[model samples]
Target: MVGRLDGKVAMITGAASGIGLGTVELFVAEGAKVVAADIQDEKGAMLEKRFPGKVVYAHCDVTKEADIEAAVKKAKTEFGGLDILFNNAGISDRMSTITEITAEGWSWIFDILVRGPALGMKHTAPLML
Candidate 1:
């Protein structure tokens, strides 16, 4: 049977665990090659082994623009081009309330939740087009 994503290539952030891990599995099962981007080296390495040629692991800290750029490049170099960008990396402040959160905590969350995806989209748009 022809999978819906046959011949497609995807880059998924936070891919070492949780939703991103699930997505990597789904995309691969549907015949899409994947670039699994995350900070968890061991888990990310496991993904490469689990999927072999269908998945490439890229060490991506979403807060860093260079990391995002590198992951996008990996998708292009490894899979030829990107058909999808799953900007799924995220985190939460450990503080109990917003008032308890420090400026650094806010910046960190903003970097991951907002700046990260924005950078992902910015870098990935050219390949998708």
Candidate 2:
């Protein structure tokens, strides 16, 4: 059967677990090649094994521009170009109260939530165009 995403390529961050992992599964099932980017080396390796040639694991920390850049490059090199960028790397603070959140916690959340997606876009926009 012809899949909807046949011949397309996607780069998905936070792809080692949770929603990201589910997305990877769905994308590959739909015939899209995926670059699965995450800090979880062990799980990422598993994803590669599960999907074989359809999924390439990229060890990426979204807060870092270099990591995001490298993942995008991997997509380009492996799949020839990028068709989608899912900036899904994120964190939820475990603090019970607003006052319980420390400056460091805020920084971590912001870096992952805001900076990560921005960098993902920055690196991926060129390839998307």
Candidate 3:
């Protein structure tokens, strides 16, 4: 059967676990190639082994531009091009009060939730079009 995402290529951040990992599995099942990006080295490698030609693992920290850049490049190189950039990596401050939110904490959240997605777009947009 032809899958919904047949021939599409996706790069998924935070992909070693949680929703990101779920997306990676679904995308592959749907016939999309995926780059699983995360700091979890073992999980990432395992996914690559499990999915074989359908998935490649790229070590990525959303807070780091170099890592994000590397992921984009990996998608392009390994799969021929990028069709999706799934910006799913994020952080939160569940226990911190507003006053307890230090500048570093704020930056960490913003870097992962906002700037990382933006960076993903910035780096991948050109190739996507």
RMSD of 1: 1.1
Which parts of model 3 have CA positions greater than 4 angstroms off?
Answer: 93-95
TM-scores, each model vs. reference: 0.96, 0.95, 0.94
Clashing pairs in 3: none
Alpha-carbon error at 46 in model 3, in Å?
A: 0.7
Q: Is candidate 1 or candidate 2 better by lDDT?
A: 1
lDDT of 3 by residue, 3-47 (tens): 999999999999999999999989999999999999999999999
Off by over 4 Å in 2: 93-96
Compared with the true structure, what per-residue lDDT tens digits does model 1 show for residues 12-123? Answer: 9999999999999999999999999999999999999999999999999999999999999999999899999999998743544767878888888888899999999999
Instruction: Tell me how far the alpha carbon of residue 117 in candidate 3 is from the true structure, in angstroms, after superposition.
Output: 0.4
Error of 2 at 2 (Å): 1.3
lDDT values for all models: 0.94, 0.92, 0.91
C-alpha RMSD between model 3 and the true structure? 1.3
Query: Is 2 or 3 the stronger prediction by lDDT?
Result: 2
